[model samples]
Target chain A: MQDQPLHEPQFALHVEDLTVTYGAQPALWDIDLDIPPGVMAAVVGPNGSGKSTLLKSVLGLIRPVAGHVRIFGRPIAQGRGRVGYVPQRSAVDWDFPTTVLDVVTMGLYARIGWLRRPGRAHRDQAMAALAELGMQDFADRQISQLSGGQQQRVFIARALVQQADLYLLDEPLAAVDATTERIIMDLLKRLRDQGRTIVVVHHDLTTVRRYFDWMVMLNVRIIGQGPVAQVFTAENLRAAYGGQLALIEGGAVDPADPHP
Target chain B: MTAVLEALGLLFQPGIVQTVVLGAALLGGLAGALGAFAVLRQQSLLGDALSHATLPGVCLGFLVAGSRDLGAILLGAFLAGGLAALSIMLITRATRLKTDAALGIVLSVFFAAGVVLLTVAQGQPGAAQAGLSTFLFGQAAAILRTDLWIMSGVAALAAGTLAALWKEVKLVTFDPDYARALGLPVLLIEGVVTLLIALAIVVGLQLAGVILMVALLIAPAAAARQWVRSLGAMVWLSAGLGAAAGITGALISATGRGLSTGPVVVLVASALVLASMLLAPERGLIWRWGRAARARRGIAGRRVLAAFHGLAEAHDDPAYPTEEGMLTTLIGRPGPGVMERLERDGMIRRVDHPPETTRHWELTERGHDRAKRDQGGRP
Candidate 1:
């Protein structure tokens, strides 16, 4: 340890007894999780599995009934600068009166502080982030003009400008082209290789072992979590999916299979 | 109240027409700028609720002062508008009803209560004055110098806050969740923005009245959104359009004896919205129609050219001359001007028809290249 702020230095994300409710209905119940630093992770299960609820709870946007979520070895609130988020594209209004560059610039507004505006240097930084996602030419174009994949790239660019130690993305690859999917995956891997942790809410079960090294199977509660090869087995997938097993590919992973 | 009515009558006198117009413009500008945020956040009805909610406050202020005091009336209006907003939020939060139902509930209930209060206040001593009713439909000519000063002070505060918190406000309007994730005080910022909007509505309460003030709040912003693609431009244009509507309406109404300024202003604002919808450069209806028309022409031209290419391919000859009848049969008769327009653009040229009754045409090199390209490099 470098004598930094850490209750547990090994885990980049720590969630204990995390419970969330929507009105009287429990969305997530008494969950516990520990994800070590610098691993690309996936949270997978059938639809309505509390994946987005879990992420929002960790971000402190939703009020959870009971939970403690730590990021980079600190409380979620204290780790604001250390965590970046790529929310679902549906979370924003694309037709809002703003340009792509301005949307990306918003990522720096918190760091830029209040009562001050972003200047040339800040814009240059935003331009560079946009360039990384191949969206530099669209910096001045209005956001409503972007395609779904371009919109996803713009969001990833915004997150990139944060340069946080931990990143959480909700279904970035869903509905994107294979090329776009590869580009985003490569970008995430690059970030992880630089010692940052990446956690994605993924839907594609076939790519789980191929794309991630750590897995967290969640369905209202944590069915299993740990290194992908260790926790991602046929038995765990069946338990997480249950009656909705046919909804997703619960049969994708076989207990006897090797890296299929 | 008599004095206020006297002031209204005085503005019609030769010297102060500009003063009344200026006052109305300021009111419109303030409403328009704040309304930009309200419209963006999809809470335009919130303004309606807040404005109507101020009616009871105006009655209370009149009762408490025993006379018409503009400052007391404004403060009371501010508080009441704020309370209405809070009530709407609470209604939506405490129950499953969405914002629309909540706004409607607060608007009608608060306005009905105020009407009842107005009747009660009419019976009390000194509250029997007639000018207090001007707050319902609004009489712009009734604006006093003190009222103008109060409006200016409120406008200044709004402008100052918007300039200082421009980034946060834009971000909050666009994505409050992301703003919160970035450690911004999402709730506090939202609250402040909502309060500023309420303040703007309160200030416009007397100028446009409770009934028509929401037009100034929503119309200008809605119109401006059609013309601009940036929040900054939308707000500025909204303010300008609002001011324009205000001045035109006030001038027109002031020319007539019984015309109320509020309805006239709303009509002018609505006209501007209609104009923006029809004529804005990119988002306008006419522009979209024109673009669609041009696209249709291009597609038709491409198909005609591709038809020529098809004839050349079928005959296994590169320089085949196709008769008009044959071309028509290949793809149903091209529109009458389709061939002429293509020839005018130098994509095709007519040839003399020998031993044939119809005109024949051949594609120029340009037309041939285009035809080949549209068909993905085919024959």
Candidate 2:
């Protein structure tokens, strides 16, 4: 594990007893977690695990039924510029007419504030971020012309241009090819190396060990979270993935078993 | 020609030219900007349907007021158009009926109702009923300065609202989910955009007529889409294009002896759309094909270099390979006279063959190097 220099004790993200609902159904329930600064952690769960909802709740995208979120010991509003997000590939209309460079430049829009145009310095930063993601050649190409992997890379580049301290990426690897995945992983690691905190909503559990240093196993609730070795136990896995019925059957769950 | 000139003089003397141009330009530009959002939302046909739906309102306005004043008619048109849009929204959300079918259904039924009322209005005992027919086909010659002022105000208001909420509108248009996740009020933004569209259509009923207002809403925006990538640029360019279309339509309809203004304006707008669809920079068909052709040519040039590299790897042979057979096999039938083209351009040399026989070809070092670099292959 890479050593990160610690300052005063301030968590990068703090979600205290958060609960969210969609009509009558509970999307997230009593979730409490504190993410330390400069760690790259993954939120792993099944399809209905409220991963996206949890992220949205933290970002104030969705109103929680109960609880609060703080960034760097303060509310999210005070650290708005310190948080950058990369949405899922399918969430955007790929046929949008904007080019890669145009999309990437949108990250600075909030920073550049309203009505003011982005200047050469912003463009240089955007291009540099694009180059970091190896998307420099496709800067002028319309988003529709890009393959799914390239579009994911372009989105990651957009996030990189934000220069945020804490980055929240939603399914950044979904629909991406191997090369794009590698580039994105490398970029996340580089950001981590720079003492920036990253929280990724990731799907591939098998590659979790290879890509992320910290893990949060969630199924509508946080089963456990910590260093990989501490949180990757069979007990936690069963608690995260197993139902009460499965727990009654055995502590160990079979992958082929319907109960598991 | 003399009668036409006399009529033009009469039209201008009455100050109809300034009225129609200013009215059409403002209304059409407003519709164009709001219509860009509708177009991006895949709701262009919805505006078309609502424009036709506004006819029933126009007829009802005439029946109620017994007057041909623009305000009464526009108010009625707004109600009818708003009803149509709401109905479409309800049907789409409540049932399996698609947006296009819902639009078609509303358009046909409302248009039929309007036409029936129009026929009834023709037999009514009022001179005001006579002017109602022009709303169906738009007599631009009849627009007064007051009407132009109304349209200019509507355009100014709509444009200002759009400009003020440009960021939220763009975010909502492109990715409502992302906007929602950002805690942006996406539904409110969509409501504002739709309200602007309704306002635009209600105003366009006077300038381009109910029957042709859809053209005013869609054509300029669609044309501008082919030219620009940003919503702001598209709106600005669409406004300019709409103004140009309006002026051209006004000039031709004013100068021509018998041509109606609405259809002429629609036709001119359609022509601009056609030109943009074929020739505009980004999304134009011609530009896409041109780019694809260039890419293919580049790939072919790479293949030629691949063959050269293949030959270079074959042996340290200064014979520099010769055989039209192997070149054909290597480059895969180089487009009719492409081999001859390569030879003529001095990129490839042909040697050891009769004038008619299959000639062997080899690349010069310049061609060899160019192909390798183009393909990102070894030199």
Candidate 3:
């Protein structure tokens, strides 16, 4: 993989001076980032930070006040089909009368187009995705009947069925059980190994080093972003978290590793 | 019985009765199908506001056309309803006012404007405003053949739209943010849904009137919701229920002396909702009540068995018969007929002691096994 010609390897995501505001208050200030393809990256930050806002901006759910976001070195609209998104679990009404298989089938709606119902092939693809997430048995069950972990897995399965080259998740591990955390982490690693770029809005500082290859510490603006081992340092953590650094400082950082 | 036969005969003969029935049924079905989305999205009141908001548009349409041209009136009503919906969206999005407040504000303001416009139109020197008042309370008997044609066209459009975009609509209603992220043209889908709802309300004005039309939209869907667990089933059931209510109400009203059709139709839909609330399985209030009662009885029976096991273990005799007073004390209530129920259930036995002795209970072997299982085998 390293021997190939490198003419500025196209980044999976490129943000230049992106800014977002809600009303008069700025939710995210000027921010710039470039994430290389095939890396599992984590956007870590304190509460009230623009972690979710950034993801929304990239997905075009929220219009940025100033600047642009490019996916695969092209506009988001041009490459939207290649991008899959897993929004926060809380963003949806779980009580909606839909089955797991029905939700997974929605991933294919963009491909199916208007007036065309999903056929047997779409159903088979959905089932295959559910099987990959170990959720095949739950295909017929209403979404509300599933546990938190199972629901998160269903969301993941929905994204998986998209078969996109780039995946963006917003707080996928929040409120999930340990089993789900493990399942998600393993699946993310596998996707990365298969050359898919995955970016996640992550909160657990302890798992950042172990689960992600790259890190972007943000608090309204980009604080530091690079290889996890280099940019995920005590100084950068302090800069992002302020006085609340103690909560994440203990047991999460390796003091023996020297920082340059 | 003669009156009923007469009414049925009149209904079958192809006149005002047939047109009214067909128009009511079409309106009911469309409202029901669209109302399912409104109910699911928790926008039932939004439907009310939108319906009321269409009044101004109806008056405006009548004024502009100088007559009650069905097409012109409907077009005007659609535009007014659409504006009301847009204003509600804007108020909620651009200000501190919540959705309920926005709905209330828009509903009342638009309705007042409609009333004023209606009065102005009524006073016009040459205007034939005799039937204009029917839009307020909806005189189903006044439906004409042309109106029926309009109703059928709207119904067809609504049904076709639902069929073509069923999946997209469901996704947007359930999770618009996710739909937007998937680049699914979330705004366009939402606009289409709002348009369909406006169309339903406009076609319904002649049959149900604007004031009571929302009941047609909400009641049938809300009733069907009690019986179904899937969106597809809910949509179909809601449509059927709406049609049934419309036909039945229209027929019954036709049989009676000078009764308006709107109230009758709404009453039938309300009856369906009440029946569903009381009788539908799983989520019905009565079913839940019964389940709770059964669960409580099971708990009491288990407590009695546990008391029996405790006494037997203490006395080192499996056949020990504990008095009813002891069992009551363990259960924390007299529970008047619990012992008899347990005995009938074969979980307990009445031991025949001396004639003067108080009745004592002993656990049957089956009862002891159940007690152990219920208590998780804890001593």
Candidate 4:
């Protein structure tokens, strides 16, 4: 193991003037963002808010229209085997009759390259991953038998098996039980402690303050992004979550004070 | 029958038997393995289309060389079958038409064109022209030693490729999205799986014929799926089943004169599928019936326990004593036979001290745990 590399104290992933378009409609407009290493940062927004698109651009799954995304000073492709991705749970059809262990082992496919079978070492690595998520009991159970939370955990385990320096998880907590949510949050904290950067697409606003240390408040564009306490305030909340802004902003008032 | 047996005995000489068995087995195994992915991915119909599409290429090959060289015919078949697969892919991707409809459209049109080509080829003066119709019914007896060698070599090559890419194939077929997210070349992997299917169908066309080759690809795989859960297991099972079908078809056709080997082989494969459907452990009819019977027994056991639970909750004093009517109410169906059955099972006992015509029921120790687990209240 080597010492973690550093670009700056407050930046791990850097996106410069990123823009993407689907045909004529711009899915993402000019956007610039930075996320430092070892922090659980979130890209929070509503539907079609470019939250997923941003992650895809970073992963190089979709080519950006106009900018570069660098992982620790190198392009994403050069960072292969160092970045892990967990796509949305709904993005895949679940009725294909594969077990949890079978799916988790897919993480090794890229590492092994084409035309080679996963050897004994790969199976051992996969089992370690399953045990990490406490899913060893269901390892042989078909993926379709899993609840939403278990499926999400299986995806996380797959990412864990990748052993990447940075993890990009999309809506991992969505539709999960509270215990599963806690487990994921704890796993993210552990990953961060190990000096890995984790970028998550989060949905639950209530738990966001407690769960994340940094935030990329987005609504088709960045509202504000930095430390959660200072950067995520009433004004930024209003900009990002427009209609519910007052409800959130109104709760910010100190209750003991009589004056506005 | 004796004469047929004697004839088969003559053909069973080591050289001939070894050639036919090894050739058919290799061919069957390759087609079956590739077809597992095709059937799993719901592209079984593509096998049909590609098999028919090889005809024009065969004609083109004959037309080009004016000879029946195996190399020329194989090249032509590969080109035409591959083009057919590519066209199917393009149509589905470029148009709103769904896969099944597009496959149907392609299959009929290409097959009709092949029929027209065959008609035209009948007037052509060539030695190769004699066996063009043989491709339709598959002349197993006419499989020369050279043809066997080519088929065996192609089968080995295809099987090797499949084994090499098995994991990638399974991943993409199971979940293309996850494969894409991991930066696996999904299009390339899919193209490989498709190409393997096309290659299998093309190679099989001369042995199994266009009309029945689709059956060869799908039946063994579909049959194998009924018996296995893992992709590896399914592939192995499919290969075994296919080899068996091929050998049996060849033997029967060789021994019994006037039978077409291709249709016989397909029929053998279909019979395997039907047998698996009826007899497999997980999804078969027998297993399903067994499960249903067990469920009925569980429900009967629960009804007895429900009667006991009713008695335990009956009185205001709640000392757990109740009359006969509670059993009927708790069970949700009024029947004298249910009470009698419950008593016979020793799950509940009829009260003897009550007035002669009426009786009360109470739980045995076994009944308590059964009821608790059912309600999910406790164990």
Candidate 5:
């Protein structure tokens, strides 16, 4: 609960000069991004555009070649356990032998402390998170038996169980059923209303404005960053997605137009 | 029958056989407990690679001591296994080689070096490394009370570690990225798990040779997975299954002459895997097959009902009953039993015509609504 300095505005996430390279290829290059607290924000880009890299770098999962990240004006080291992460659904082997309740309980592993098991209170908390996501009925079901949408819900529920102040999700809506998308979006919005910051790595550009209030258009480097109304302009899309997107839309799109 | 009785009775008698059984069982249980993590982490071959890599350490331990001192050799094997695990991890991470390739490379190279070292040790004067190669396919007869104590200590350590870090290990194995996000020491947990797996492999060295040790590690867990839904159940069941297999194999070896315990134990574990796969509830092959058969029958029955409903619609009479033979001819090879099952389920019923002809069947009122729903459109 350390107070921020007088000069520093409280950004839920702040990255300064972040550059990540896999071997000779740079994934994210010299990027600076700031997302204020309590806004449903998005990291928008096409494939291989470092949307995931930004999240990973912010979480300090992948060591960036340069730059440091902060959550709420503090370095990641000092901000530990305050940020919740939902990795890509495909990041894990879904066939692993585990129950839905067990996966959600993973969020509290840090709070449960090292070497200590999750007690009944922890289980109730996990169950409550699952209930929020409408996955309470699947508490005992094995994860592998779930659909893609259910898997995404379970992932979001796991993040919710963490009860972190700042949440970073990697494509929570991708390939999910319509119901799951709405449920997750509602949950994220609820978190935002409660003054929690949620940043999503988003791919579907058409729905970006509708889904997020804050946007950071990214293609290796920052193309645009600010309110979606300002950062989601057609020109920004062209810069972020490049000719690959132009090939699909066939022309420039207006951010105010709300459709490409 | 007498042989079986003798084996069972010999297990309870106080002797070296009991010690060997206890040692093998403890090692098997430890392997099962630790292997659960390795297998869950998709590193089943890590144990295999580490076990094979323990060869040179065993040879070196023998050579250094000029005698087959069990503790020194085990320590050497433990170090070698750790080194092998580290090498495999590095090779996979630093190079383009995949995990299996790294495991294969380390396993064969270390095993070959161990073989060569064994030969060299044999050439040395005053070398008492005879039967050192028994480590290749564990010589259970060589197990002593002290070996049992070692196995017990290792098992206790594995159990304690698992108890302390069960949640963290599960989180890491399932998703390390999230574990890192939660500020858990993902790498440290992984290292500890791998180190324990290596210790388990080294302990199992005397019961299941390097060639068969992987069996003890994987079989029990694989089998337990079929019968359980939770990781806790899987690990506990796997460890228990492993212990049971160990005791059974040791007992069998005692009842017979010239049967190697390692291969016997491995065979027992393999049978457990096979049995679990075939017979475990819900997830088992037989149960799956039965479910599949039922599904196929249900689909065929619905198709028949829909077809019958269609025929009635074409005839513009909802009660239009068709000859059984015609229905069979039209459906063409959905067995006669399929329609009978539909009738039994009240979806269809048999009827008789005024003329002396074969009985006819027609969709019931409920079946008509179901068929229409299945069609998803009006006539």
Candidate 6:
């Protein structure tokens, strides 16, 4: 029940003793971590390694059997407006009858309050977000007509319109073209430069060194988590991906590291 | 013509015909607005199941009240539909059965129970169940002035609720998990939407009847879906279409002899659906076919232009007037039709030899430029 300043918190996201189970099998087990503010962190893991589950649990989309998550030194509900979320690309019905502008405007729903529609100021903000993503020309286009990369950009635009301090993206780079990947990476870097924290569930290890500063490797449990230069080693990747680690040997880790 | 005019005249007069028309319109508007959510959520059959599930409650109301009181019947229907929804949720949650299976089981079982109760009520003497069977396939002529007042009140309440919660409902329908993450009371919003759907189904029973009420719930919204690209527009368009269909069916039924209102309304709604499916601009079948046809023609024209470019490249001349026979050989057979189309498009020119019937075809300057770009300076 501690009420503290909104901007100052020990960690951008803090998870304590978190364990998530789907019926009998465990999805994520007893995880504890503290993500510092203003770092672009990648949650890297193999398929079915609970990367998405971890993000969902942190966002309060899924409840853990035992443990709690705090964002900016408070429960998620207390600072709901300060957190932005971009769910997986396949999470929504793309064929739904909605325009790009309308989807972007949804990010301001929490701020707009109940029973009140978004006004011109909110719309201008959404347009600005779309412009930032180079999708302003497609503002009125139906979402279903967009390509996979454009769709991903629109999702990012929605999250950008939230103007939140902490952003959680689930596989934002998956299935996107090279240009879209670069745009997203640059946008994330700019957010970090502006003192915002971004946590993305990333798959490609090759880009981890270039795109992210911090990393969290998971295989139903925390494998390693620290600065990317320290924890993102071939050894850690082998542990997270298990024996399926092919073509990832040699020079995958930082050369300066002595952890060979 | 006179019969139609008389029916139209009767529609404006303050009597049973006018009352029935107004009641049906209100039912349609409310059901349409609520049903858009159902359609978007891909839960159209849930509305069917819930409406059919209302039958047991209607019989229970009759058995309890010992009379044909509209309020009691509606309340009974609401309760039964709500219980059915709860049971469906339980079965789906506790077991491995999917939503469709659960809904089917609940719908038929509840409807059968209602039929048994209805027979029991009819066997007992002194019970007023004379027009009770009309709830199955609605008798518009049986509508009373009192029913209109209730219908209007419920319609206003339901529509107002939808307007007030429009944003929350949109978010939940679009992405429930994200709505939950936003801490927007996702469960409460979903529960309200479910209750409103049940309310819509209960109110529509008297007008559309239990068996065919799902048409009113789904058809108008689905039709609107074809014509619109935003949820707000779709909702309003669906409501308008539903109201129109309701009024049209009522007017038609008034003109005909011994025709029931519910089936006529369903038919009208089905016709709107068919029209929308065929004629809507972007998503309609007709529009898609037309676009595909245009694309195929364009592809053929491009292929002919590319063929011209290939012939020019082989000769290393930008304005090579290749013989018609050689161009035909390059373009594959059945080439004259495509050649004519290319000529019409101004991409190629035809040069006729005066003595011989044979002609020469060559690319125009514009066509040469296009050909060069197509060949990407390969030559």
Tens-digit per-residue lDDT, B1-379, candidate 5: 8988887776788778888888878877888877777778888888888999999999898888878788788989988888898898899888889889999999999999999998898787656545887888989988888778888888889899888888888888889988888888889999998888888888888878888999899999998888887889889999999999998898888888889888998899999999999999888999999999988887888778878988999999988887877777888767648977888888888888778478888789989988988888543
Compare the candidates by lDDT and give the number of the best one: 3
TM-score between candidate 1 chain A and the true chain A? 0.94
TM-score of the A-chain for all models: 0.94, 0.89, 0.93, 0.90, 0.93, 0.93
| Proportion of native contacts kept per candidate | 0.98, 0.35, 0.74, 0.47, 0.91, 0.86
DockQ list for all candidates = 0.90, 0.29, 0.68, 0.43, 0.80, 0.76
* Per-residue alpha-carbon lDDT of candidate 6 for residues B1-379, written as tens digits (9 for 90 to 100): 9998998899888998898889878888888888899999989999999999999899888888878878898999999999999999999978879999999999999999988888887776645545777888877777788877777887888778878988889989998888887889987888888898898888888878899999998999999999988899999999999999999998899889888888998899999999999999988999999898777776677767787778888889867776767756876553336678778878899876556578777888888777767668453
Q: What lDDT does candidate 4 reach at residue B237?
A: 90
What CAPRI class is candidate 6?
medium
CA lDDT of each candidate? 0.87, 0.78, 0.88, 0.78, 0.86, 0.87
Q: For residue A104, what is the lDDT in candidate 5? A: 90
* Weakest 10 consecutive residues of candidate 6 chain B by summed lDDT: B327-336
In candidate 5 the C-alpha lDDT for residue B359 amounts to 81
Clashing pairs in 5: B138-B209
Off by over 4 Å in 4: A1-10, A91-99, A112-121, A140-145, A218-224, A229-260, B1-11, B14-23, B88-109, B126-131, B134-141, B166-187, B252-257, B308-346, B349-362, B368-376
Give me the candidate number with maximum TM-score: 5
Q: Give the Å shift of residue A229 in candidate 6.
A: 2.7
Clashing pairs in 1: none
Estimate the lDDT of model 4: 0.78
> How far off is residue A150 in model 4, in Å?
2.2
Tens digits of per-residue lDDT, candidate 3, B225-336, equal 8898789999999999999899888888888989898889999999999999999998799999989987777677777788899998899988888886777777676365
Instruction: Score every model by TM-score.
Output: 0.94, 0.77, 0.93, 0.83, 0.95, 0.93
lDDT of candidate 6 over A140-259, digit per residue (tens): 999999999999999999999989999999999999999999888889999999999999999887788888999999999999998987887767877887676654555364423524
Largest DockQ belongs to which candidate? Answer: 1
- Model 2 misplaced stretches (Cα beyond 4 Å): A1-39, A60-83, A94-102, A108-150, A157-166, A177-183, A186-197, A219-226, A233-260, B1-14, B83-133, B162-168, B179-185, B255-257, B291-333, B350-379
| lDDT per residue (tens digit) for residues B323-375 in model 2 | 75776776677664556656676777766655647667667877766766766
Model 3 residue B99 CA deviation (Å) reads 3.1
